[model samples]
Target chain A: MNLETPALIIEEGQVRRNIAKMAGIAAACGVALRPHAKTHKLPEIARLQIGAGSKGITTAKLAEAEIMAEQGIDDIFIAYPIVTEAKLERLATLSRRINVIAGVDSLEGATAMNETALRRGVPLQVRLEVDLGFGRTGVPYDHALELAAAIAKLEGLQFRGIYTFRGFFMNGAPTLELEAAGLEEGRLMVELAERMRAAGLEVRDVSVGSTPTAEYAARVPGVTEVRPGTYVYYDRMQAVLGSCTLDECAAAVRVTVVSRPEPGRLVVDGGSKTFATDVGPGAPPLHLIGYGHILEEPDAVLERVSEEHGMVRVPEASPLRVGDVLHIIPNHICSTVNLHSRVYLQDGGQMRELPVAARGAIT
Target chain B: MNLETPALIIEEGQVRRNIAKMAGIAAACGVALRPHAKTHKLPEIARLQIGAGSKGITTAKLAEAEIMAEQGIDDIFIAYPIVTEAKLERLATLSRRINVIAGVDSLEGATAMNETALRRGVPLQVRLEVDLGFGRTGVPYDHALELAAAIAKLEGLQFRGIYTFRGFFMNGAPTLELEAAGLEEGRLMVELAERMRAAGLEVRDVSVGSTPTAEYAARVPGVTEVRPGTYVYYDRMQAVLGSCTLDECAAAVRVTVVSRPEPGRLVVDGGSKTFATDVGPGAPPLHLIGYGHILEEPDAVLERVSEEHGMVRVPEASPLRVGDVLHIIPNHICSTVNLHSRVYLQDGGQMRELPVAARGAIT
Candidate 1:
């Protein structure tokens, strides 16, 4: 297919390889993989992962979980804390149709979920999100047990287990010290599970996610599940951080050089609207700069991106011309994927369009 | 309405006032106003602008034009240089039903448009985009005449005139010196129009767009039309830049505080995915920092935004609790608007949802 510029392109071979590799790792470590569907937001990709041995799927929002449930994906875990009455209502409705897993970090949020479930005549399985240094959401590790115990005691709520997302270490390959620290973090989580069990709480699903530490966490003695979102479409940021090789990156944006304004400066049709300006934490050893990486010209940098203009800086002697299409590996694939309604899958030199099923499902 | 958190809220009163104010500016300057639809991307809003005495509407992509055409919006000018064959075919089809005007800066793009128009047995109205120091796209003003002349000579193509978007000055209100610079830029555009007329070319529409410069450019001697998008939804960035007052900001993201991690640190459901991290060219005098401004708490900075979490830094004494829904005025309304599929219009204290019809129409 002669595709349009600023189109999201996914390599099917690379996607399948990524799925199998992560699934194999999880299996070897005696843990179940519930790959996050928020990255691709496509039911097709989620099905492929399940076919490759994924136990279930994970979503970032209730809307995404609803979309996945509509597509007949029976198991879904919304890895976000659902607090408001409206979201809890939607979650209760979603739970009736699927094996829904909700996350909560506060007693109020948990009580709200329990109330919604009771009103809807459904059971809400919840996992307490504990802070493992990400500092974004999740209760402090010290406070997880209290919230988990309270959630367990709440009516219409089944406190399944605890989950934590260690995102700060996503920047690069953990140094030996960092690796030891990760193991220690996982040990603490396992210890939390042991403490909960000792307190007569049924802690079944000890989940750990965050692409950078999935492998290390999967091997933890008590961690039963992993929920890595970016593995299906590793981005430039992940490659720089040694999470995956550049060749393993499955997602890319195809853009055309629309204007050659100056000798060394060019403008591409894709910009921040397509390739989101999420300059993932730059791991110093890799030296990746700018917004994303250009496949045709390795040294060229997409220095700046406005709404619809990507200012590419290349060598003055570069032979680039208008109308030439180039592929860009975005800094963060998840946010970039959210920018497009449809994504093209390249298979056997043919491009196939797949609707991004849950794009803009931030609610 | 019991709504989900992290939703876009548009104040209907402020939006109508914004439209009327901009329309009044154009009418007083004796120029036609073609408000850019890329900001709101809703046909309902486009109709409101037309109702408020807009000549037509300007779109950023051909897909938006098609969507508007479907909604019975007959006149549309795509302010982007689209070159690919697939897009030209769509443009040709769109032109069949609507009065479509395309922007082109190079001879190659103009020729392609002419060829497509010829093949489709239709006439294409074209505009030569000139660079007036917004180093994004557009041809250097010096080289525009030659391309315009070439476009004028092409088959099935009508050279409608020229246009420029002074995006560089969008950061803040023009200082006295910057205002003088803007007037000088407009003067040059008028001179360019005179040169084209002297060269025996029929130049009818000399258009200028950019919310910050629209009023100044419309008063230019020969500028027949002006397009300003952000005037419809004056965001925090515009307020700080003196484009509009904080009370005049029409659009905001209504998010709920999900987690209060610490005394001074709170997390909201809206993050980079909702409030895009468009820091913008921060004007020093205004002292705006971070992503967006909280309408409820003016001094509370949305310090950091990740994929699904917004880390807000407020005074420790701020009594923010979970489930408190707050409105945020984003830095760049256009970018922030594109992040959602549906936007809520607060009409007379009641919120109504409107689908963002042209969102993700980047191609």
Candidate 2:
């Protein structure tokens, strides 16, 4: 396919296989699969996941959920706390139409949403986001019970169980022992849910897991649902973390060699803007050497990047030349996908454009 | 302004002041100001720059130049090498309508563009991008003269001059001695232009300088133009590099504190997706301590970020709470602006939305 350079290409066959494999894993473990829509911000991909036995979809932002809802995806779990009045009002309006589950971490956030729910006369379904040592968001583990009780007391909100996100962490740093981390993540969340249930608070949906921890977390009995966003389009990070093989990585960026300035360095048309800088080369655990993995020349590393130029380090004897096309599997596919407005899907012999419907739905 | 969290805000007063200041500097130095449109990615902002005495606009991609041309900003310079056929065709098409200048670093790239220009019957005005130790793009300094002669020989291409990008480098690393670095950057490019002119090559426009080095580079005798992108809306990096004060930073991401998960930690709704991860905390010369600088609580550091949450570490005695609004000046505004579709322009008491028309124009 003669497409433009720096184009995001998603292979349909691998994506289908990835979806099926994850769905089968959840099915085998007898847990619900609510694949996170943040990875592939397309409504079409969400529908495919739902068709492949995913119970629902989970989004990192309210605006993404609204886009999915507008495109006819009914059930969406916004696994992010909505604190702003504008977002809360939008959430309430969305909940009036479809099954929208909001995330609550603090009393102030819950109270604000409760007021919006009460004003709209639509009861908001919320799940307390337990902090699983990610230290990014969510309620602290020690205070989860207290906040859950407080949220349960809100008249216009239904406290539907709890959820947490702990992606492969051990002793404050990213760990390669995925099994140990995933088991601990599942065990901790399960124990919390049992404790909440024992205290007479209703805890139904115990959602947990990122792409790396999903299957292992699903092995735990009480993890009612698993939300693995990147499994659909496994990236270089996932491949290094032993979650999926490099071949299973569905998304790849097709870039052209624009300038071979020096013997060892080849500059490509793609850069930090094409493949995001969120996951860096020095990232821990699996300190995968480059910004991306070039499919053809495995030895080449995308060493440095400016806004529009990717400086690639290749063997001096390498046959790479200016105007040559190369496919790169990005380190993190989710953020990489978020950078583009649309992606080309290569399904069998046919290629088609899929608009990232929620491309910049950060709000 | 009760706008939603994670909204990109551009202070119109600061933006206008920044434009005039840079324009004034260019005027005083007797060099043409061609502000790089890659920073703001908005035609309105480009028009503002042109109105403030900028000769033209510089873009990193041909697609961005197309957008600027379509928006009626005219005289464009795509300071990036166009290697692909599709992009070359687009560049030729753009050149036909407006005075479009393309960048040429390699003989292959020049030949390809020459082919397209020949086919389209338009002589493409080209600039030789000399490698000034950035090691990202551009031709090697030693081979630049040879390449310039070859490019000038191409029948369908006009070798206008030479350009290079060396932001801040002393020896092999980014240095704090901006004056020395900027002076060296200008001196080297001027010497190259003089050498090319002595060889009977008609070299006129010698463009150089990023935001940090623009004024200093413009001081050199033979440098005809300055193309500083980030000065229009100075970011944290520019401020830290002494290009502008923190108050001079016009663009910021307005975010709401969503979760005070821990005593010393507050989570904001914006994360890597909102404020891009292109410029990290450990960036050289100035090891900028966080993702962004909070205008409200200047002491708080946005330490860690997930896809949707920014973990801020604040003083124990800080009075910040959940639902509080915070404005953040991102480390790099160019990549940050590319992430958003629209930005709120705050001019005095008036606020309005300006669409980032060329936001995802990375071809």
Candidate 3:
């Protein structure tokens, strides 16, 4: 495919290798690798992950899960908090085709899930999500025990287990202590599961992991599963967050030099639409001076991105000419990948196309 | 629409008023209005703008232009520096349906477009985009004449006029100077047109406008048209850019507070997914704060956004429990609107539904 500049290029070999490597790690750890399909909505990649030992998959939206199930891969986990009536109706239909695991933190939400399950005459599976310091979602650590117990007692609902997304486990968390904290969080979750068991409820699964904390949390005695999405296409943000080195992060948005009308400036076709404007904490607004490190210097920063162009402030003088192409690893790979409908593969300068199966799972 | 949180809302009344006001301003200034359809990306909004005296519609993509043409829009201008082969093929198809004018800044690009048009056995209409001090995509002012002349001489292509987006017109180019510079730029375009004509070529149109410069640029002497897309839905960035106030802004994303695990920390269903993480030239990085902002106060800063959750640092020591909904005015409206499939509307209180008719105009 002769892709326009600034297009998200997904190297097929790297993507497959990333998919398989994570699958191997999960297999080695003895946890059901339900690789979060939310990271890459590609049905083909989901099948690859499954082939590589993934028990099933996970999505962020019902529509995405539905698409995956339609493609014949069942047993899906939608990690998003499902609260809408429309979503519940879809979830009800989804239950017949696949084993669906939904996330819920509130007692009211748990009850609603139970109610929906009863209406469908099927058991709705749920994960008692705990806010393990992300401050994003889930019950507080103090409130987790009660929520877990309530979920365990809810009728027409199977308390699958407890799950938490340690997305906030970024560079802010020191590496040495980060793994320690993750293990301790797993311990607390294990304690919660013990409480569920003491209350005469079966707790089969205790799952948790982000790309940053999966290795640490996976070895924790009670964590039966781990879901890390960004490991597949580690981004500049992930590199900064210390999950992977620059070379290990194997996806980039390839863009063309569209306008370089003057010195100390150059614009590429990839803008907020292609690369996205996601700068992780402590990073510059844009990795400027170079939208990317020209691929050779794989660890270099992608210093700039505007709406329809990226401003790469070249060093002294960029060897790049007006039509030179460059590869840019987005700061946040997951969101950037989600912005495009297809990914390109560049092998020996030949670009192949790969559909981003879950590009618009915005619901 | 009784929209849930994290929903896009557009007030019909405000949108009507904004469209009409811009149309009115352009008419009063003796310029034609060609409001960029790329802003609303909706056929209905195109109709509205056309009904309000827009002579034509401008789009950034051929898909958008094709959609508009299918909806009976006869004239359209694609204002991006389009050079892609696939897009050119679509442009050929679009030209068969509508009066398509494309932006070209380079002689090579113009020649390529003419070659494509000739191969398709169709004529290509184009405008030489002049870079007027803004260093985005365009021929520099000094070089615009040469590019224009070369394009005019190219077979199967018509050199319509000159164009430039005043994006380089500073972040918030003071409204007074904005209009003055626009008028001066218009004069320059008109002078270029005269120079081209003296060199035995006809110059027909001179167009330019964005949300910030739309009201002023249209009044520039010799300016024939305006293309302002975001006017229909002014975002917080536009408010900051002094284009419109929050009230006059037409759209906001309605999101729900899903969890408040602790005081001073609240999470909403809307995150970077709904309201993208585009910020201004501020420091400490805009964070996860309570609500992207109360719609009533567009300038009230929204501090944080995660993928599935928006962590809003509650401004005051107040009780913000679960199940509360708030309106989020994204930092950038154009990109945020593109993320959703459809927008649920309201006067923000009541509810209705509208398909963002042009949401997926990705060519």
> Could you say which candidate leads in TM-score?
2
Q: Please write out the lDDT profile of model 2 over residues A298-323, one tens digit for every residue.
A: 99999989889999999999989999
Measured with C-alpha atoms, the lDDT of residue A207 in candidate 3 is: 84
Residue range B119-222, candidate 3, lDDT tens digits: 99999889888877766777878877777777888988988888888673443333334566656666777777788788888888888777777676666676
Question: Candidate 2 docking: what grade?
Answer: high
- Looking at chain B only, the TM-scores across the models are 0.95, 0.98, 0.90
Full candidate order by DockQ, most accurate first: 2, 1, 3
List lDDT for all candidates, in order. Answer: 0.85, 0.91, 0.72
Candidate 3 residue-wise lDDT at B218: 68
Question: 1 or 2: which has the higher lDDT?
Answer: 2
DockQ of 2: 0.82
RMSD of each: 2.7, 1.2, 3.9
Per-residue alpha-carbon lDDT of model 2 for B191-300, expressed as tens digits? 99999989999999889888888888899998899999999999999888898999999999999899898789999989989988989898887689999999999999
**Number of the predicted model whose DockQ against the real structure is largest:** 2
When summed lDDT is taken over every stretch of 10 residues in candidate 3 chain A, the lowest stretch is A284-293
Residue A144 CA error for candidate 2 (Å)? 1.6
Over A1-363, each residue of candidate 1 has an lDDT whose tens digit, in order, gives 878788999999999999999999999999999999989999999999999999999988888899989998999998889999888888888887789999898887888888888888898999999887667788988888877888899989988998887765433343333355556667878999999999999999888856777888777788889898899999997787678888999989999998887778889998878988655324343456878889999899888777888989889999997888899999889999999999999997888998898999988
Please give the lDDT score at residue A170 for candidate 2. Answer: 48
Candidate 3 TM-score versus the reference:
0.87
